[model samples]
Structures are given as C-alpha cells and as structure tokens.
Target: MTVNARSGLPKDRPAAPAPPPPPGWRRWLVPVGVLITLVLLFLPGMGRGPAQVDYGDLAQQVAAKQVDTLRLTADGTITGTYASSFDGGEDFVSHYPTGLQGVDDTFLSQVRDPSVVPHFQATGATGSWLGTLLALLPFLLFLGFFLYIGRAARKGMAGGLGGIPGVGRSKAKVIDAVRPDTTFADVAGYEGVKRDVTEVVDFLRHAEKYAAAGAVAPRGVLMAGPPGTGKTLLARAVAGEAEVPFFSMTGSGFVEMFVGVGAARVRDLFAEARKRAPAIIFIDEIDAIGQRRGSGMASNDEREQTLNQLLAEMDGFDPATGIVVMAATNRPETLDAALLRPGRFDRQVTVPLPTQPERRAILAVHAAGKHLAADVDLDTAARATPGFSGADLANLMNEAAIVAVRDDRTQLTAADLSQARDRIILGQRQGANFLLESEKRNVAVHESGHALVAALSPAADPVDRVTILPSGMALGVTEQMPEEERHLYSEEQMLASLAVRLGGRGAELVVFGEGSTGASNDLASATGLATRMVREFGLSPALGPVGYSSDSPQYLGGEQVTSRAYSEETQRVIDTEVARLVREAETTAVELLRSHRPALEALTRQLLEHETVTGAVVHAIAAGSTADGATRAPVSA
Candidate 1:
C-alpha cells in the first residue's frame, strides 16, 4: 500500500469516481430561467412608453390641427399620437385636471372644429395585464428577498452559517479503516502504554470475541502525561492497528463564540462517530473543555455546557456499538471527574518521560533517514538526557541534523549532537564577541564555582561540562548529568543540589566581595528548592516532619493560590526553616569554594583560555591537577 505523504494515510484502494456531470443543455437551465425572470421583471420599465404633456398643451395641439389621434380613458389619462411639429414627439400622454367632471367644456371647445379635430375615442378602461404585473413588481421582489432570508434563517437554525454549508459541523478529520497508517511498529517506545491500548485495538478488530466471553469493552481511554510524551501518537497507533475508522479532533474545536455552539458541536461530533461505528474518536487535549465545572468565577458556561454534552454522549453510547473515545491532556488534574469515571474513560494511561533505553529507541526511530557519522553514539546521548520525552528525543535528532547542516556538513557527528543537547538545555549559544574581557572573566569564575561545588559535593550529580560562553539568558552555564536515572532524592542530595545552585553567588561574594544579578535565577531556584524541602518534603527538623505543601499538579507547571493550612506562627517557623536551609547551603558553597580557591582560579583561567571545558578537565583541576594534566599542590583557604 502506498502512503500519502501529507496525510500519512495508506491508499490501498482507488478513490470512488466522481458523479458524471449533468447534460450540457441542463447545466444552463437555471441561468436561462434567472435571465428570463429578470427580463420580464424589468421589460416594462426598459421601454420609454409615452411622454407626458400638459392638458393645455394637448388642447392647443388639437385646436391647431396637429393632433393625429387621441384616446381618453375613464381615469382621465389621455394617450394619443400627435404631429412631430407639436412638441417634436409622435406619441404623447396627458392627465385631465381632477377637478373636471370629464373632458371639460373648455377642453371640448378645442376639439369642436371639425377640420382641426383628429381621430378621438372615449373608453372606460383599466390598465393592461403587463401594467398590472409591473405595479406588483415591488411586492414580488420583496417576497423573493423574504424567501432568501427565510431560507438563510432555516439554515442557521440547522447549525450552519447562513448559506454556508457545514460551518457548525464537527471539524474532525476522519481516516477510513483501509487507510490506517501508523501501526504499533511505528511507535518506538512506551511499551506499557502500547500494551494498555492493545486491548482496545483488539476489541475494535474483534468485538465478537469479547461478546462471546460476555465481557464489555471500555468506552473511553484517557492518556494523561507531560507534553511531548507521544499521547497523540499512541492514539494514532491504535487507529492503525485496529484498522478502524479514526475521528480525530481537539477539545478546543468543540467550543465556539456562539452560545450553545459548543454543545451543538459535541452532539455533531458524536453523531458522526456513530455513523462510523467501531471507530476510534480521539480528542487531543481534552482538558480544554473538560475542566472541573463550577470551580470558580473563571468557569466558562459554554465550556461547561460542552463538557455536559460530551458526558452525555459518552454515557449514552453503548460498548457494543464499538465506538471508543480516547482523549489526551497534559493537565489531567484539571479535567472533570465525570470524564475519568467508569463506563466513560475507564482507563487512564500515564505516558511519562522516556527512560534511557526508551530514549535510545526513540532516537533510533527519528534517526532512521538521517545521515550520521560513525562516531555519533546515540546510547551516550540517551544517557545524557534523563527526563527527555519522546517528542524531545525526536526534536533532539532533528536539531542535531540542523546543527550539522548549519556547519555545512552532510553527516551529523557527535559534536553536532552535543551542541544540539546544549542548545536545548542551556539555550542557543551566543557569539563569542558579545562578551567583554572583564565580563568573560567574571562568568568564568562564576561557572568555575558551580563546577567546583558540584564536583566536591558527594551527593550532587557529576559535573558534565562547564563553559564561560554565554547562552540564552545566561552569561555562563555549568551543566551536571546524573550517572543513572534517579526516581527519588535523599535529604543530603537536595541539600547538595542547593549548594551547587548557590555556588555562583558564593563565588561572586568570595572573589569580588559582592554579588551580581547573574545569581538571581540561582537564588530563586535555591529558595524554591529549600521551601519545598521544608514545606513539602518535611526535611526541616523545626517543621516536625509534617508535609505542608498543597497538592498541585505534578506534570503541569503552574502556580496555584491556596490559603496556608498552618497558623501565622507556623508560617513564621516555615519561613525561618526555609531561610536557614538556604543560608546553610550557601555557607557550605562559600566554604567549599574558599578551600578550593587555587582549583577555582585554575579552572577559571582555563575557561578564559578555552571558553569551554569538559567535566574531565574540571575534575582533574579539582583533584590538584593542572589544566595540562601536570600535578600541583593544593592551596588552603
């Protein structure tokens, strides 16, 4: 089967042929009818009928023997042919004065001369049929306009923009069962996630098997994870594996500015899904419309109504009907509980960040068509990345390729991958010419301080690289990578982390007798970590091992306001403990830097020379070895 490049759907069979066009003459029938109607409507006005003449002028013309013919109607309108000499016109019309009984004697005296009088006739008559029709033309046009508006109103009532078809309909893109493209094989990792969704795929492919066992399938599955964890990709894999119709949409698609439009869209979406039974309806980012209802004044009535309709549809659909709803959201904590209940989203799959092996696998998948140098070790790259998601890994591979292209190289090398990782984590590197010599020296010292503390601290992760080169918002950076993945951290490890974070500030104070704004981010990070240690981790002795932090979302990063559960006096204690922890960490960093003053100076000087230094060189300098691998005696504080 050939795959469509744009849509990624398979084309195993030919598309259905379009209906034949109508007969040639029939195509012009509507346009011809419209033309005829317009001509008939405007024909009377198009012709210049008769020129109006005054009654006195007509009498003078008749008395002068210039009038050739005359006909007077009961309504006192006189129309007749006249000599061109009378008024340079052959035909004329005149209205008698309404005050006159008939053609008055004054007007009749002009026609009394037998020689002057032309042909004359008096007839009590009404207007011709065409004139009558012309008189009602306005009413007919108004009726046509009213019908056009009424038709538009009816279309609007049917949930469509007036005259525009399918504006209010669901915007889901449906993939036919035969066009399933991304199977499980295409997904690199998330084995557990794939396993969890496999049952749904099986049920979709073979509903009779479950029916025979009297087992009901789950109506919906919710994939909750951090952003870029491949939740949507997993849903696509399910569609491919099941070989069933796939209806995909985002939660935000259901909402519209118009009231009741969101609910209407929800109904329309489900109706379309029902028409394609055994289909998988995947809604990406369901939290957009599935947030907890009536939470606060921020609650949106339209979104709430949409959520209500979705709940109704999910509950209303039968498992036997073979329609499974799958939704994904990074902010699952914000979703309404009804969506996660049994019979709705019976299963909630958590797609967390990839482990080292999974990262390696994901890298391999993204690297399939890319040209890589022989020395580019993906395993090492994976090990360096601890908390990277599948999408991040994919982006990493692409960024590495971009780096290679930027350097005018065809094959991505290890250096390209390393630079890409640094760009991702520490932001893009700034030009070397941007920093002044003095600023560069200070940055070198600051980064050296961080590297020294991280290398010396037993509980801290190993320093990976140190650089005086400015990147992103920072003038310098010291990156540390863990030797292995760690799910939990000890109190010592947290304290060590705090010290490493404050190392730059400590260096600033020790070397320059002052601090700079460069440490502002470090201070904030240290303070927040210390606060969490005291309040959430219950690490502070004064806090009595009691957790005090509110339950905020784990994956979704945002601040939430919550009233402190503890008293004001307890708050004071909490603050005191947090300050003390931060002070102790800073003090440790200061003392460690002071003791390793010679090593710090050596590392800083090396950074000044090279602008970038590896962890091995930093480790060597910290262990009483010079930058050139020569032995040196350690200096005391």
Candidate 2:
C-alpha cells in the first residue's frame, strides 16, 4: 500500500497563526530609500554660516569703542559680540584682509585711551579651516552613525547584523504560487520515483477523501540518489502537482558557526511551514546536517542540534496538519537513523540511473529546444550513454549545441553528438603530436591490436573506433561499443574483456619484442579487472567462491574505504590468482594477434594511412575485405 493508504490523519483544521513575513522588493526599498535620504542630508551643504559685516564697519565700531570683545583668526576673519545696549548683539561675524595690522594697531591705540576704551582683548583665532571642521565634527559623526544604522536595517538581520537572535530566524525560501513552474512532464525519467511521490501529492491534494476513508497521509518522503538524478526536480514536481505552498531550503542553510543557531533555524523553518498548511517542505542535501550523529572525531554541536531539531519537528507535526517534509541527499548512507524512522521520513525513494527507454525519454526532453539534424537518432544516443544521470543528459544536450555552434553548423548532427560524447568521456582529443615515423607506427600498431582483439574475441564488446591522435592522457585510444547495458556479466565475458584491455601490450611484445610505457594504462586497467574478478566477483577457482573485498558506498566520490576481509594467507592467494588471470588474458591476446598477424598488419597500415580508423574499417580488415560492409563504403579518418 502507498503512504496515502497508510495515513489516518484528519483533514479538517482551524486557520493557522500568521507566518513570519517574507522579504520582498517593498521590504527592501523602504530602508534602502531611508539610507539614501540620510546620505543626501549628511553630504556637505553649500554657503557659509551666520551673518556677515564689512571689515570697514567692524573697524568703525572699534573706533567708536562699541565692541565689547574681539577675536582674530589665522585666515584674517574677525568676530566680536556687541555689548547689551549695542546693535547686532552677540551674533555678529566679519572678515578682513590679513594685511589689516594697521587697523588693528589703530584700534589698540584708541583702546589705550581710557575714556574711549572698549572692553576688547585679542582672543583666539576664529573661522580657521581646522576650527570650522572641528565645529562640525559632532554632526558628521552623527550622520555617519545613522548611515551605518540605515545600511544595517536595509540588509536585515540575516546579514549578520541581528546577532544571535537574527541568526536563529528561518532561511527558507517560500513559494506560494497556485502551482510550481516545473511539473512532472518537465522531468524526464524515474517513473518509480515519480509514482512514489505522486501518492504523496495525491494525498495532499485530496486529504479529505483519505481522511474520510480513515487513512492518514505520509508525513515525510526522503529522496536518495546520486547527484544530478532529479531529486530536487522531483520535489518541485510534487509541489506543482499538489498546488500547495512550498518551502525550500538547503541543509547547509540551517547550520551556523554558533551553537544552537542551526537548531533555531530548524524550529523557525517548521513553524513557518506550519503556518502554510498543506505545504511541502523540501530540504536539499540533508546529509550535510543529518550525518550519522557522533561520526566525527570532535563533536559538531551545531549540526547535532540542527538534526535534533529536525527530528523533533518531524515527530511533533500532526499528519492531519497537511505538512509533508521531503528531503534529498546524495549521501543517504551517512544520514542518521532517527531522521529516517517510520513517522519521520517514512519512505526513502531511490532514483537510480536511467534505463535505456528512460534515457531515450530524457534525451528527448532535453533535445526539445535544439534543432537536430535528420541523421541525429536519439535512440542511438541513449544506447551510447549507459550510466548517465538526468543532469548528465541535459549537459550532453547543451554540449551538443555548443559543438554545433563551434563548428558553425545550423543544426546539431549525429557527428556533433558523437564528438560531445567523446569530449565528456575522454577529455578533448589533441592534434597529432610531433612524433617520429617509428613512434607513429608503434601507436597505430597498439591501437590496431586493441581493435583486432575486441573484434575477434567471442564475448568482448565491438570496437567502435581506433585513433592514434593524442587525447587527454592517452597517446592512442580504441573505443568500444556495447550493444546493450549489462548488469550481470558471465565469467567468459569478464575474461574476454580483460584480454581486450591487455591486447595493446600483447601486440607491443609481439612486434617490438618488448613493451613500452605506452601500455601503463592498459596494464593498470587489466590488473584492476583481474583483481576484482578474483577478490570481489569470486571468479577464481583458487580463491573458491570467497569475497575478500568489502563494498563501498555506491555514489561517486562517496567514502571509498575498503578493508580486506581475508587473512594474509588468503591475500597472498588472491594476489597470485589476479596475476595468473592477467597473464592468461595476455597470453590469449598474443595468440589471437599471432593467428591473425596479416589482418593485424593490414589494420595497422589502415590506421597509419588515415590517422583515424572507424570500427567498420577494422572489421573489414579482420574479414579480409577492402570495403567496409557495415558502412557500405571505405570508411575515412
């Protein structure tokens, strides 16, 4: 039964409390405008301060003994406050030339006469630049202080301004549209995943029906898959289908350097999600915080608190409230068990790599915007990519478009797709290196050997192309084409595959009477395959159905710690068996090359002439024909 069938929660509930306000353009504009106004008001204004009086008027007043006190500035400006009975009392200011020493002396002489003397003393300088600046310093300080405050207000507390309290607030991005933009139709594959999520969406959309039937909706669904497998996209599609509020946040968004901060965010996120009932809360990359508790050497109090808060929220929420928590993580193996318990993330859906038909659907979806040439067959492209995720397929389509644009082509052709695939698989192919004729011949012979062995071996994949041109780290490459995906390989196929890998060195040994460093990659690959066959696949008779290697997490870049499960004696036997397998494969490759020595020579000559030889060309040479039967013509470089 689906999660909807299991849920017995009621649908009827009262209105929720008001949610914390979402940030918007209006919220930002108010504080930003205030800051801008403060900036305008605080900028230095035009014109001088106070009233002005001529230097002559000030001297006449001094001559009449009307001034009570006087002050002179370094810039030759004067100020004096008039007596109580005098005009312009206490607020008068005046400017005079710096060369007015004669006037000042005359005034002093007049003042010496007791009867005409005014209470005037040469006080400290007034109206100096430094003095004026010092006078306005307090106002400037106020303006700067306010400007900083305004900026802080505009950015909100999340900019680390609000201290511990602000950091505790939720960081979820709420989407309250009638429907999300990305529907299930937009997603390409993972039908099983879609079905699992569809049941949740149906329960959300029709909760009353399920409630009437005494069913309660699932509280949570966890999506576990490798990166780029559309986990997040599927969550969006679920939201779109349910037509409810969607609150999205990454697991890392809840974490902070401070203790209890992540927990606060977790509480805040759930509180807001509850405010919008029938909502989908999606936490992407949840393993960031939900990692198995106590796994680290030192304690991660912040992450642990966040995980605990999440667990509590999931447990505390009523299924009747119509809040379903959905989370995605590439490293599901690292998540805490509490987070995946029955009432929490009740269902864990695995979105695996697309199968053949699923891949075709993915290709078709990604190809919608591109103009494809008639020769571009999506089915063929799908068959070529065995382990590509949905994101990889999208990237492939984009790379194909880029290839088309680079080549100045109007539409994407089969050749563009092929080149894009090669670029993704092996790094970009390099131009011919400036090697000697002998070196070139050696590379051609090596590649030809690989193609020859692959074609002649009973269970080996067919050779797709052989090239002597440098590509990435390889000086030569022989691409193989599997007709279909193979999950379970027989012992015969594994041995044949191992022999094909060793064919380059076998040919080098037969032709040059010694192997060069050119076979380093080939030997490494053959050794790895042989080791797996003996230790992991239990293919060695000597090892006798024993698996000496432990399995690691499946996701790429996941923890790859593999401990040997066997004792030292078994390890020695394993090493011996792996070496024996490699030797036998090499021997088989050498025998095949020797038996078809003439064909091998002919294929090597073709590669030398063309610089690149198609698989059709290799097959023709192996079949003693000059024309490529597969292509109905002589294939070129």
Candidate 3:
C-alpha cells in the first residue's frame, strides 16, 4: 500500500488503467481530412487564373487597344489576354452589363474596334450550381461549428460549460463505486461522529440484512457544527468505507440567477442518484437554500422553490432503495423546519470542537511526517489549545513546522510550538525597540499585575507566560493556560477570571493613580464577564437564582440583538448588579496588587529586562523567592 505524503493515509484504491492508444492511421485522419476539405473548397481559385480587374479598368484597357483575345459570357463575365509594351502580356477577367440591351449595346460599341470583337458564350447550369455552392460555403461551416458545439455540450464536456443544452443537468462531482482516497483512518478523532456515520455505511453494504429484519435506514443524516469541524470529511469517509458512488455538491451550486433553475437542478440531482441506487448524495452548507421560508418582501422566491424541490425529493425517495442523503451545515438554526423534520433528515448529528484527547490525535495526524524534537510535547500543546476544531489543530501543527523552518531548523522544538501558539492567539510579535521608555515601563507593569494576580488566585488558571512586547493590538500580554478543560464554571472561578482580566487596569490605577488606554481590552473583557456572571450564570445576590440573559446560540460568535423579556425596572436592577460585580472584582485586583507590590515590581523588572517571563518565575516571586532562586520576604494582602 502506498501512503499519501501530505495526509499520511494509505492509498486504498488500485491505480486506474491507462487508456489504449488509437491506431496510427486514425491519429492522422483528422488533419488529413481537414486538409482535403480546405483544398476542395479553394482548389478552383488556387491556380494561375486571370488577375480580376474592375469593369471600368477593363473598358479603359480595351479602348486603348490593349486586348489580344477576349471571351465574354452571357452572365456578364469577361476574360482575355492583353499585351502592353510598358508592362508585358497578362491575362485578366472583368464583368460587363448583360441581359440589358441598351447598356450592352453602348458597351459593345465602346470596346468594339474595326479588327476585334468580344466573344459571347451562354452560361450553363453547372456553373450556376457551383457559384451557389461557393456563395453558401461560409454559412454551412458556421452551422457545422455550432452543431459540433451543441453535441459536445449535450454530452457534458468542455469543463461543463454546457451552454443551453446542459443548463438543467446536475453539477455534482460523482465519485464511482471504487474505494475513495480518504477513509475513517484519515480522520483523526470524533469517534462518536464516526460511529454514527458508520451505521450508514453498514446499511449500504448490507441492505438485504436490514430488509430481512424489517429495519429501515434513515432517509437522511444532517451533520451540523461550527465551521471547520470535519462534517464534510465525515461524509466522504462514509462513502469511502461503503464503496458506493458518492455525489457531492454544495448548497450554493443549486442556486442560480434564473428563476426555477435551482429547482431544476434539484430534480436532476435526485434523478441521477436514483440511477445509481446504492449511492450517497452529500450537500455541503445546506443552509444556503434550506433557510427558513418567509412570506413577504423578505422571502426569496427562487430559493424557496429550490427548498420546496429539495423537500419533495427527500420525501419522495425510499430508504429501502439503498440511497442515503447526507448534508452538512454550520448554521443549523437557519435551516428550514421541513428539511430537518422526521421523514426527511431523521438523524441530526452534532460535530463539535475536538476535546483535549481528540485534539492530541488530530495533532498527531497532522504531524505525521514532521520532524519534532524531544521536548516538543503534543499533550501539552493540546492542553493549551482548548476549543480548537480539527482544522485548527491541523493549522497549528502546520504553523509550528513553519516556525521551525523560519528559524533555519529541521525539527520543531517546544519553543517553536510556543511561538506558533502565540502567533495564532496573540498575533505576531512587534519590534519593541521602537517603543518609548515610559511606554515600555507602563506595559511591563500592566502585564506584571495580571501575572501576579493569576499566580496568587487559587481559582484562576495558571499564568503561562507574561510579555511586555507589543503584539497585534495589545501593548502587553499575560497568557493563562488551564490545566484541564472545564465544561462548567463555578461562581468563584468566574469571579477570579474577572479579577484577572481587570488586574492590568488595577495595576495602572495603583501605580500611576490613573488608568491608560492600554487597559481598554481588559476593561471590556472584565465588564462582559461580570455581566455574564450576574445575568447568565445567576451568580448575583440581588438577581437571585433567575437567569436573565437572552437565548442566543453559543457556538455562533457574534453579538445578537435580542428583545428583553423582563420589564424596565428589572433591567435597571440587572445593570446595577452587573456594575457591582465588576467593581468588586476590580477592588479585589487592586487590593491584591497593593499587597504584593514587591512581587509585582520584581516581575515587572524581569519583563522589562528580558521582555518575557514564565509562570514559574512569577509564582516563585509571589512565594517570596527571586527569579534566580534567591529567598525574599513573602508579601501578603
């Protein structure tokens, strides 16, 4: 078995056979035929015929006694050989008036001399037929060219630029019933998602078994998740494992500028799938056409028609036919109810972000052939990257390799991975040499405050690294990596998180007696966290145990404007509680900074000198030990 160099998956399918070569004579047939046709079309005009002159020029030449012999036809064509002392002898052809008695008599009188008279011949039917055929040659060629194009378009060739004839054909990429390039092994994790889809594979492989037990397979499976969570990959893996024909198309592929085009495409897609009975149809990003239908100006008639067609096709197909439809979408909430209803999409699978173990596996899959140093720990990397999807993990591994290459190294080290993580999360590091001395000192102090608070607070996550170097939009950064993933947050943890977020502003207030614009991000984060704690988490004493926040989708990362369910008076109280929580957290941060002034100063000095300090050093300093292992008096609040 051969392995894919990039993905590290074994090639499962046999190599396709090369097409047999055509016969040698057949290869030259087209060019020879084209040559023969061209010769036939222009052969009569190719020989040394008379140089055709205008009627007036011929009249002038004949009037000057330049003609040796002339032949005139009843159709008005004239041909002759002329001799001139200045130029030499030449044969020429011209035309004169014919079937007009007065014009012919006048021309004949002008060109006729005492010694010479033009010979006239009657035109034959053969000449007339040849002239008509030559006149219609260009139109015939044009018609033939269009006919060739129409034939190719009907056969769905020329990259599917099928023109009018293929407008209603499905644009799906059809993979045949041979094993595909990807399988379950290619996908790193999400075992539950794999299992859920594997059942579909089994049903396709053994349809008779399911029928014998009177078990009906699901008509459709809907994979809904945040973007880049491997929903589409899962569908492909299902097709690969089952060794069935796979028809894949995106939701936007069905939509077109013309009305009813989308509906026509839907019909074509289902009909094609039916032709290959045991096949799978996978549509990605189905929400584009499957959006909730609305009546009014807001409704899109074309999109609604497409959705209606899709609904009918899904309900029209039988599961026992061994055909299954799979779809993926990031915005499941936007999908129409008819698309997700019982008999349509019977199973809705949620593919969420990878957990820590899953992330480690994903990293390993991406790290297949990459060189890593001994200290490059994947577990540590996975632990640090919480809420990362499989795509993110893959990107992280690639970024780490890039960092290694940037440093002129072949193997990725721990520092390379760290830098890669920082680059992804906090943006690239900016040159600190351009910073003013006062600004540098202020940034060091701000980050030191955050580090000290996080190290001292038991509920807060451990401070991973603190830096005064500017990165992205921040003047300083203090990163805290959680030891493990936590699905639920206690009230204490929430309050400690708020304090850690406010620590920078608290330090600025304590040291300079005022807060700078550097604390803008911290202030915003603290305010939001405190509000969530009070309103959503119901951690506020004044608000009691009732959750007051609106029901917005959590996975969707945007601020949604929702109508408040409570009255104006309750809103006022909620606002007061939110402010109180933020104030309490800030006060706690200020008191902690005031008490551990020595540790804060020590940490800030280390940051200013080295530009970065680790969590261990901060913890040591907070515990009354210098960074270089020197003992110091412990500071307490």
Alpha-carbon local distance difference test for all models: 0.82, 0.80, 0.80
- Candidate 2, pairs of clashing residues: 7-215, 7-216, 8-215, 8-216, 9-216
Candidate 3 local lDDT, 1-637, one digit each (tens): 1211112223334756775685688789789989977987788778687788888777777677677667766667787777655246787878775444567555577555545434433443236556787799899999977786666566544322334565667789888745577889989888888988888877776766776899887889999999889998887787677666788999999987766678878888887886676678999999889998983336798899999989888885332245688999998988988888988899899999989898988889898999989998899899889988888777888898999888898899988888888788878888858579999999988998898888888888988888887877777789889999999988889888988988988888888889999888888888788777777787888978888666454332355445666888878888898888888888999999998888788888899899988888888888786567743344343
| Candidate ranking (TM-score, best to worst) | 1, 2, 3
Point out the worst 10-residue segment of candidate 3 by lDDT.
1-10
Cα lDDT, model 2, residue 132: 78
Clashes of 2: 5
> Candidate 1: deviation at residue 413, Å?
1.5
Candidate 3 clash total? 0
Q: Candidate 1 regions off by >4 Å? A: 1-164, 177-180, 298-301, 317-320, 550-562, 626-637
lDDT of 3: 0.80
Better of 1 and 3 by lDDT: 1
> Which is better, 1 or 3, measured by TM-score?
1
Query: What RMSD does model 2 have?
Result: 8.4
For candidate 1, list the clashing residue pairs, or say none.
Answer: none
What are the TM-scores, per candidate, against the unseen true structure?
Answer: 0.75, 0.74, 0.74
RMSD of 3: 10.6
